[model samples]
Target: MEDDNISDTDRALGFTIPARHARGRIVRLGPVLDTILAAHAYPPAIEALLAEALTLAALIGSTLKDAGGQLTLQAQTDGGVVKLLVCDYKGGELRGYVDFDAERLAAGPEQPSLFALFGAGYLAITFDQAATRERYQGIVPLDGDTLAQAAQNYFVQSEQIPTLVKLGIARRADGSHVAGGLFLQHLPEGEEGRERLHTRLDHPEWEHVAILGGTMGIDELADPVLSLETLIWRLFNEEDEVRLLSEVAMTRGCRCSPEYIAQVLGKFPVEEQRAMAGDDGMITVDCAFCAQKFPVAVTNVVL
Candidate 1:
């Protein structure tokens, strides 16, 4: 019961269960994820962690109020394998990178839990909207077994909303990486609305949907052969109504450009810029997000 019409690449489907009063989002990342991860040669564990970060960013960023806004998810840790992992999302475009202690990663555990890999860290979500002068940020401790759990914790702690997230990452037979995720949130009803609906803050529908969502396997989540619609139906078709709201296309995009790089370099003193120049008398900078290198002439760097 798969949909033959839609491509199995980067896409997100937003849906809702009106009877259950729940909202959910499902995303599949194919070439978009492969391209982003292939830019850097990271260890398997580090790569998996980065994939989860990117998937979480996409699920949460799609909820941004402004179309021109960007959402960034960052994890800063004092662990052996990872120092920082950042993912940026804007208008369905996503990019991410990981910073790890090479020596530590080489000697670390073969397979560590998310908490072990990112020990004693904080997860921060920041919203940057072009229309607003001030950016908004929320920080929560990383105390979960997985990145999705951390995100769910954020919503429960910061927004006071009950949320659940399931994330999966795997390598295809061809050695490329792909990721998928499911996000569900219970819509809070106002006091009057709750009375009319006979729904309490701890509604039974939320637990019911979450229990059904827990049945999803990682393979089903990450498999390109499986259609998102099929997955949705399999999960919640038994409900009164499963409505598809919209679908968004995603791509591997980076915000870094030569002009932007030059502007950042301009902030430094000329002497400092000169000190950063290579033997060829040019300053080379590599974008942390995309790993794209931009070489600028030392003389062209305005002080």
Candidate 2:
């Protein structure tokens, strides 16, 4: 299979081929990206970047189907609350956040470059399996300026697999957000298949494919006039036998629970917990991802 026509909408609409007889690929994303980023109050640049990262993260989680697996993409800066985390669970639930210095948003976008915003950081992928399997983690330095390039680098270095990620973010006129992305990877198989696919991907025509794939903007995606199905056909309508696997949808969900928070509170020293709990006899825990606040009474917390 030629690795030339890889695009987000193409796969979002459904692109399928056998991994053995052909290279299997799927790339789909849209409103779900907006849903994840819309829950937060983020600056324009930061919002755009994180949305792109979240799109890729969700796609990865969906594609890598492991009932007990979860993937988290975190980018932490040196001295800012600008930390970004997007977590994906095995069941296709996705949640994301942009932690920032309160004053930073007021100071404006000029304060931090993407690198400085997330200084000296790294990208990590954690995998968990069934039967209480040991978790595996792979971490790599953030060598690229953009998250797309950084993630692509991670696959190249860690898995010895060549891949390409294209992400685009746009601001809507009514203050909404939209994002879309594509991931093209050279699958590990026979040397002949790998070499042929790599050559096509590196071709100049492939650049045109990449360029055109990113032009679908926020307005087009969010507009009711254009749906994911129409968008995909717009790209690869000419292909006769393009098979779309099951359509996967992504939404924001926080894994935090009252029971989970209670366990966390138990980690602190008894004296500290007592001091914070106060005479009001209650503790409030807000989820970092969804901002869902949970208030628990002192009597409810048990060691």
Candidate 3:
């Protein structure tokens, strides 16, 4: 059943329907990246690197709810040559950082592959549960040519889930960046649900869904063609009925805060804190994601 508030067309992208409410999510990941990562002038290769991470993070985070569970996506390569972490909790808040050879920036986007930036790295996906349940973690080698393909490989090899992904990025006329993407997955249906995908698996149903999603171009993301309503309707018009649930609004948000920094500083022994503070008796914390620095006085520490 489609909620009266949601039109079938609108469910195409950028909102979360509760679990079982909807089977998949389509996302627009750019513009937000430019806002968060492009403020500082990074060379083109690094810029693209961050852009891909941001896009991947958005898609991964879309799977769960912000109220309790948060998804962390990590790409760590050899000897700190390339290490990036991007986390998007259920709340839509996101933060991430990229580390690579500054000289490599001159090497150009084509020269450095995502893996080259961080050689011999692995991709890790972790689900953090708030309810005292165990956190779940999965790892896959970074093997694919593009981030999307790498993630797709991660699904097949690590999780054994059949998934398809399409990612497109573009720069806006005003210089902001925008990225658009789609994800389609076929899972074992319930006795009845499984009966459906299975019955249709041999048929053209899965292919039909993938083909429509792949057609969406950069323009659809930069500026949506139809509201989320019409888009979903048009895509699933073939189904007996597609159910659209409550809308979840998403935006660019960072979870970093002063108290969070204090906790990190507290992790060190009091003596180590004192030594790091030096004669000034202060410590500095810079957000890896946005590079914003927070300076705190030693006196502020209860220790």
Candidate 3 TM-score to native: 0.80
Number of residue pairs clashing in candidate 2, backbone atoms closer than 3 angstroms, sequence gap of 3 or more or interchain: 3
Ten contiguous residues with the weakest lDDT in model 2: 17-26
Query: Which digits, one per residue and each the tens of the lDDT, describe model 3 over residues 7-28?
Result: 1211224432222222556666
| lDDT per residue as tens, model 1, 180-249 | 9999887746211243244444778788978998899888888877888989999997888798967888
Model 3 spans with C-alpha error above 4 angstroms: 1-22, 79-81, 108-112, 191-208
TM-score of structure candidate 2 = 0.72
TM-score of each: 0.89, 0.72, 0.80
Better of 2 and 3 by TM-score: 3
Model 1: clashing residue pairs? Answer: none
Q: Write the per-residue lDDT of candidate 2 for residues 100-178, one digit (tens) a residue.
A: 7667656755545666667677778766765567676777777676777888787667765555566655655776555
Q: What lDDT would each prediction earn against the true structure?
A: 0.83, 0.59, 0.61
Task: Tell how far residue 287 is off in model 2, in angstroms.
Answer: 1.2
lDDT of 1: 0.83
Off by over 4 Å in 2: 1-14, 18-35, 79-86, 104-112, 130-132, 190-242, 263-276
Candidate 2 residue pairs in clash (backbone atoms < 3 Å): 14-244, 81-99, 81-100
